[model samples]
Target: MRAINAIRMGGVDVLPLVEGGKGVSISNGLSAGNWALAGGVGTFSAVNADSFDVNGRAIPQVYHGRTRRERHEELVSYAIQGALTQARRAWEVTGGKGRIHANILWEMGAAERIITEVLEQAKGLIHGITCGAGMPYRLSDIAARFNVYYYPIISSARAFNALWKRAYSKTAELLGGVVYEDPWLAGGHNGLSNGEDPLRPEDPLPRVMALRKVMRDFGLHETPIIMAGGVWCLEEWESWIDNPDLGPVAFQFGTRPLLTQESPIGNAWKQRLLTLKEGDVFLNRFSPTGFYSSAVSNGFLAELRERSERQVAFTTETIGEHVAEYGVGPRKRIVYLTYADRERALAWERQGFTDALRTPDSTLIFVTPEKAREILEDQTACMGCLSSCRFSNWAQHEPDYTNGKKADPRSFCIQKTLQDIAHESDEPAAVERNLMFSGHNAYRFGKDPFYSSGFIPTVKQLMERLLTGR
Candidate 1:
């Protein structure tokens, strides 16, 4: 018999383990379906998940557009189709065994429209919706309308309380448990605010207890708090289970599950995780969307790190002050800069970092010509998907950018690299250039005896080990 400690989520007695939704194809139908098949919760990322191809093979389109609105519409349509298809796939894989959920980022321009259309269409297939990357204030209303459970992925108790007071309280019936994704350690975008210190890592138990307190105060004492991010072995979490303060807790693994046999990440990516060491992941605000993200320390991340490290406070005095040019066009102009910076850049260029890529509307600097050519090719082969990309400011009309500013190459086109890392044939280049997400405990993969058999466990195997103690 299943353990009596099972938590109820979305009206289903679900194993607390959730396959945290990863964007850009990290968590897809196959991975989520297997999670649900194991009687745990599965959440497929619907942020422009691959829909289909002419031959019906799933193909993700991250940057296929000539205009902002066009990219936005494609993202919506693709999400709707992908969500439905993935949910149905999960149902098929699990034989109707476990609960299936969909994950959506709240910051997308058409986040509301895409999500509503997806849940409305998926109907009985999708049991719940999990939203994060921003406080999803409208999540309650949207989920309630579809008669589906809604879970807001939050980092702190304060954020949850604020949401409950304003919107979620009225729809308490469908308010699914809150997901406590660790802000400092988790891969992808973090939720840490400006005042939050990343250096001093705090224990999650107290924070979860605080969340439980909020639940009790809001008449939701029974609501489970799904703990995410750095969670690893269940044995380590035994103290949390049935604890008076935490009450009805469940652990969600974001990085641990990636090593499972059933996880859909590319083999090269998996191998990279096994070899990753401490201090290899970095959190930086390099994204054009102005979000802080975590990525593995690879050649790509190293280059960005070097650039950020070598940054000099530059100023322009004349047109020739910082003169650098790329393609000849109406928008072409040399970026002005200080004499000292110009000399420093020239010296660096002589040191073999010769290629210079242009920020969409800003100035041009040096990159290896090869990297520049690759960036240009990738941009030219664009499939507009983001609302507006900083790499290619190819908007539908005159003003292609959102802030009405030019695109910035300092921030690489995120959609392009993520798509490459997820599915491209160039495995090494993908790992080298794109960011790879993993948990803080990812090193355990190399140290754990359980994985010593040269075989990774499947989702079902991992869950069984966790719940049944191997």
Candidate 2:
């Protein structure tokens, strides 16, 4: 294995390994700070990070506002406070040892305001900002305002090209290394575009090389490319070391860091990672952000799959091959469906999926009455977590504050599920019932000898093991 060396990144020399930021308090100050102290870049999630009370207990993010817009304001305030708290903690723990970066989802509600507030309050504590989950065209400007570096996480070279052309070109100096997150392998919200097929996973080497080529074309030769997703041991990536074509490169580990002692995830969630098997992680398009994400194939995901499977398209009136008329909801709204689809819908209804919920599209999905009620309640209690949510049809805009479409039944409230899973109690079953984001290589936790007998490592130990190439 090639010897790991320190690289200059974010205006400092540090180890090439990076801790990928996980949200909803999974990757907090302790984990990120420890990784930074280990001479690597540590990225703490600033997307609604947990803030503590006077007694050092986590303060639950509760909203008292009745309207979605008001609740969104509350959420932004909480986010800013939480990010500042985490940044202060990370700075204290790192003791000015290495770089500390904050991660934010661009699709998050009031992203610019939250980031600006945090940076203003926590100035100098956070060295860089890493953003993903959408086209962050304004990220560079925001980072430059604070004189900090910005890393835009992109899945393809084309995405970076668009970002550079549209906005990043103005603030080229603050363009910290670009992060090429593998859409097929990364956890949480993925960047799989309409052109890509999720089933066929491509090799990261070629894709990353393509990204490097794009960077070189833009005269970004000295800038490093951070390779995230599906990265495990350094030995496997020995060939990428000192490769002139790829230039300075680094690796970001998201799933591997979850089992570390410093990780903020609950004990049940940590233990669950060691029991996963091959194909246990699934990539599905169920996020309210309208993007594909990878998560554990638990009961939560299974229920969503089943709900989508019971769907049937409908027409307002009788059309060709849509002769059967069906009544949905208590009002008995009439719609036309194909004869075969009518039979399927009837069968689903007879099997206890009595309530039919309309989606944003011209389709109806069947679910149990209880499930339908739960979905309605969740939608009603929407706090506008995302910039535009497909599940609740809540947009951050002031005038309308709606997506101008019906709320989608196939998707659930992501904010609620992520918070529940991350802060769930000791019950493993309850934790499994919530969305558990994980990378495709999460099964390796069970297979790797390093974690044999359910042994978990500290952040420093994991970094050492990774540097040794196993």
Q: Pick the candidate with the highest TM-score.
A: 2
Evaluate model 2: give its TM-score: 0.98
- List the candidates' TM-scores in order: 0.87, 0.98
**Model 2 Cα lDDT, one tens digit per residue, 1-470:** 89999887888888999999999888888889999999899999999999999999989988899888888888998899999889988989988666899999999999998999899988889999999999999999999999999999999999999999999999999998999999999999899999899998999899999899888999999899999999988898999888888999999999999999888888898888999999999999999998999999999999999999999999998989988999988998899999999999999989999999998789999999999999999999899989999999999886899999999989999989888887883579867689999999999999999999999999999998999988
Q: What is the lDDT of candidate 2?
A: 0.92
lDDT of 1 by residue, 1-470 (tens): 23526678778787777888988667777788898887788888887677777897776555456655566567667777877778777878877776888988886556788889887777887888999888789999999899999999998999999999989999999988899988877878888877788777788878878888888999998888898887767776776777777777777777877777777677778777777777777777776556677777778777766654434333233454444322212354344556676566677678775654445434445666666666667556544444345555544334533445554556666766776787752376677777676666777777777777556888888877778632
Q: Candidate 1 — which residues are off by over 4 angstroms?
A: 1-4, 53-56, 60-65, 318-340, 352-365, 372-401, 468-470
